[model samples]
Target: MGISPLNCGWGICVFLSLCLISFTPPCDGGNILVYPVDGSHWINMKVLIEELHARGHNITVIRASTSLYIKEKSPLYKSITIELDKKVEPFFIQYLQKHIKAQVEGASAFTFFKITLGFVSAFSQLHLLMCDYLAQTLDDPTMVKSLRDSQFDLVLTDPAIAPGVILAKYLELPLVFNVRWITGGEGHFAIAPSPLSYIPVPRSGLTDKMNFIERVRNVFFYSIALLQQRLIGPHYDAICEKYIEGGCDIISLLQEADIWLFRSDFVFDFPRPTMPNIVYIGGFQCKPAQPLPVELEDFVQGAGEHGVIIMTLGTLVYDLPKEVSDAIASVFAKMPQKVIWRYKGKRPSTLGNNTLLVDWMPQKDLLGHPLTKVFVAHGGTNGVQEAIYYGVPVLGIPLFFDQYDNLLRLQQRGAGKILHLSEISQCFEQSLMEVLHQDSYRQNMQRLSDLHRDQPVAPMDQAVFWVEYVMRHKGAAHLRTEAYKMPWYSYYCLDVVLLLLAAVTLLLLSTVTMFRFLCYRCLRKPKAKQH
Candidate 1:
């Protein structure tokens, strides 16, 4: 029998609908407002921004007028510029150079104090400057009204500074963090339970396994971190009080973030307690190596069986002290491996024929090259992570900040060696040789690489998924804990402990009193009968 016309039309409609639904994505474009820290931090943030752009999210970046790495114009995102007095990054870079020089000279008590004081003062001022910028931005009705009217779906930021956190709260937007450091300390401490017994503090230069002495040292390191929180947080507190609805501390604001795309994984980071909301996106910036430029590829090919070694101190450090540079050059001279050193300083007199000095090189490409043997580095997170991604053993010359601590983790894992600045001249060549010849170094690193790559989803894809999840759900409040809202005593269960202790004490005292009364009654009756 022939099908009815009405039934055939209904069947066609159903088929087309299913096809459309199958083709559509689960999540669509979202309007994202990003507040990012400049310089090296921007490098990582830009990668995420680009990925989001490709995924069809509309991104608006709020940047300072004097921002270093963040340009006013970008194809990836629109810019909401905030005015500032002077450039902060250059000042920070200058301070780091001075600090590196101080470190290389020696670690006397006076030098330590001077360096610490200088660094703390610089960072404190930077935070205060951001607070001022935030104030200026909020105080302007035009800016505030524009922000509110934009109707951004979410606020993405690096919580290393507080303006972004406060702004996100003010706008009543779901917040997400691309974070490693918050002003108070490492991002993990800002939310997670970090027991100093096993979780070593960042820049602490200590390992996860600690002896009694090391535990004491960890406590001392934690004290410094607390001191930093105390020193740096007040400027932000005032801003929060003025702007946020009920007022909040910097840590509280950080904790409210719906998602944290953390930069380090177990490969580079020690295993520690982590929160459900924080997703590890370690090596998200890493990918298969691209083709090297003709010159670099030729140099690598020339190395033959001897292989190549590449060194870069990241963007922050360019010029080492003359003597230190000379010492490094002398050490590289005797090595059979070809060296590609990214040095912006004047040529060292002891420079070797095998070493190729350039203003910059494709670090990822070189590290991924089959001929590259060892990475000589200053232990920056970016380089360290890339080293893990490529399974290259590192011979580190740690200069400042978290450099030594980063290299120290690799040392503990048997993947790298740290040659301190003081010991560099005497031991640099030998350390390089050890890492070059040691099969164990490469093996351990390759093992880490395998584990890091064994994830069910790539780190970048995971990061994108969570970001889209936040956008799709409005916010992941179900996943977020109420612990941040509780007082310290309540959060730690100290109050409950105290209450239990008091109840137990009361019960014990009552029992003792009752026993005494019964004894007294028995003894009194016996005495009366005897009389």
Candidate 2:
């Protein structure tokens, strides 16, 4: 009676509970700072941020006012907006508008140097604004104090913004890159093994499969891109020095990054050698198809059998030349399926009864809908990824930047067809019809979608896991490749090649000398016998 059965059971339960609690891992909540380059980059970071915050990480985003639009406000994160010079935003926008118009007219017509220089000029101007912002942030005592107090564990940055790289160096934090494009320019290639023979230069419009001449052209374009980066380097260096104490260069900062999350997947991209630190978190931004707004739901549902076609040029391309719009409308009018076109500019007068124009549309939701037959897009990376995610075949009218390369990959995958802006008026109808009617395009798209979803963990979860893993381990130095530290000649084993060449030459010369000596000895012995 001294020890009761009930007391013994309670004691056993308490012991088990204590043991479980002792074995459980502690939550490693970290302060993460995100430095996004532009609105597109911010959009791409949304899902990753959401997941990290959900897992109890504190996120702080530093963005320009012009580019700071967070659709979902969360208590788990804070946003710091920096106001730029009034003239800066307008100039950047105007320059981009002009460039887009020129591209629409004919990007292929422009010389390679001209295009490369144009991009350099645009990036340089943008970087100058970023530098000004960084200088202001550093000069402001309150801002500097706050950043220091936060004590961020890691910095997530976009390499496109040189100042962001400088800021990471200033904070002395481990850097992790979030590249929104297929390739992250020279900074990415510096860390990863990017063979020019296979990996096409960004914006070069060359595919991975290149012939001898194409390979030479690819190399030439890549050289120009590298030259463009070098030309812009000194300016970036100057900006860094003006802002931070003992400022470091962009290349050095990038090379020191712990990890790089590329928004490109091998399913959509060609196979290439990647280091352990180079993580492919493509489609991480894509969420499940949410319910469309009532009106959109009704419209898509109304297209019962024929289905609907969604056309969007993404957020940047707000203004399309009248001719291009008219040609698109004309093609949509001819098609039997209903069309929903997202046009921010003037409503096209040629819009038919079967078409509806809106200033914005839920592109991902629309693409995921079963009744959506085909997507006519500008081949932006996000749009391509969405189309691939939803298994929607695309008819890409690539205009500029990485659009051409994205479309080229789509075409190679047989999930899409490409129509140049110049050819849109003539080929748009046929391309649209082919993508809609052809069974192969849909089949291939479905296969791609399957491959994209075939991973063990969801893309967003994988991203969050790796991020927390970095924080847990302090830094992922083991994952980083030694290639980044090696010189070009050393990385490629050129020294070994030279040594082999020297050995072969010495052997050849020794053999020739020995043969001549043998001949002379034989002749001299015959002369001696005659004497």
Candidate 3:
């Protein structure tokens, strides 16, 4: 009679909560060290770091003092900032401009060679700079001691600039890479078996299925990567010799990683041979749309049934050339759809009432908005993945460095259209209008979204599970292949091929000798009988 109904309900709820808590497995977290490449790659690394930190692990980021995007102060991770002699930030803009100019002028064979040589020279120099920074980091006694004393469970790194790979080896820690591009082109080329017959080389601008000319082009570009690697390898080899005990190369170190949380999956990337340790975590950063800011929400809603288009060229190239911008602005002016362009360029004289230019954007939130119909992007991995996540069709304007290739995959899937800078002035209106009116673009993208979403585990959750798996297991040596330790000649079985060829040659020679000896004896016998 004294027990109240409210107290009975509260007691029941408490019992259920206690049961649920008891059944949930606890996260046995460990200390994790992160080595991130700044800019867009950092964005990827940061997402993984956020998840790892949320799971009750400690994170330490090794950053360069000259880092563009990475901050020295952050609540998420303790940073060990390394000193650099000079910042290459200003040089990047110059490089971008020159790269654009080179692509435009690449109509001639002379400029093609010039471009290839220029690229090799520029990248090799940049590789040298990264090596120099690694040398500095290693040379610092206090830095090395701090890293060793930390006794981290693993080193999480973006291997685009692979100081982290070396550091992981030096510290004798378990290695995990948040990777798409390693030191040598695409990550697959570093560890997986990439057959040039079908798998197009990065920057070759070809797809999986290629004709004769395209195959030649793939070989040519792959040759370029090989040459560049040859130039880059010596630098890393020297670092391995100096810093790493027992001496290991960058490629070997990469192959030895405990896990590769690759930011690509079969949904986006072509089907290719992959190893067990490679975990596909595409679209891990994508989530349901958060409510936009009041003004931006009003702008999106203003489009009504016509819907809206979102365009961004990422952080590096916010401003296009004046001519290109004018052409784009003029085209946007003609569209019935409202446009939110993330541009920092001079206001185009042709910019219309339907268009709004902002310096920054909540890109993920905007893409996830229901009214977002078209995404005009530079075909970044993140942007493309987000577009796929939100089921938004794309109108791609690829600037440089895998951007075209990224869009090409979407285009091949019938979900996007690519507008090269060279074509923007003449055909921007045509390309934009085609993508705007095309129903298939939206339909195909939605299909991809469905497939990507129809996974057993969300990509982010899968990625976090793998990270924890490494920590719990100490390292994932069982998943790793022993092919890395084999000599190139043996790995490809060139030795077997040579031995087989040698045996065939010997058999033929013996047969020929026996035939000649029989003929000689028969002729001698005939001559003796005649005598």
Give the C-alpha lDDT of model 3: 0.88
C-alpha displacement of 465 in model 3, angstroms?
Answer: 1.1
Error of 2 at 219 (Å): 0.6
Clashes of each: 0, 0, 0
lDDT of 2 at 400: 61
Q: What TM-score does each of the candidates earn?
A: 0.93, 0.87, 0.92
187-293 per-residue lDDT for model 2 (tens digits) = 44766678888888777778778899988988888886777667667766886677668765667667777888888889998887777787888888787899999
Q: Which ten residues in a row have the lowest lDDT in candidate 1?
A: 522-531
For candidate 3, which ten residues in a row score worst on lDDT? Answer: 522-531
lDDT of 1 by residue, 1-531 (tens): 999999999999999999997552478789999999998889999999999999899999999898878999999999999888788868778777777777677668688778787788878988998899999999999999999999999999999887899999999999999989899778888788899999998777898999999999899888998998898999999998888778888888888899999999987888899889999999999999999999788888888999999988888777788888999999889888889999998899899999999988889988999999999998988889999999999988887777888899899999999887878778888888899999999999998888888998899998998999999899998878888888889998999999999999999999999999999988885434553
lDDT (CA) for every model shown?
A: 0.89, 0.79, 0.88
Error of 1 at 98 (Å): 3.0
Question: Any runs in candidate 1 off by more than 4 Å, and if so which?
Answer: 1-25, 525-531
Model 3: per-residue Cα lDDT over 175-255, one tens digit each: 999999987789999898989999999888999999999999999999988887888888889999997778878888889
Question: Could you arrange the candidates by TM-score from highest to lowest?
Answer: 1, 3, 2
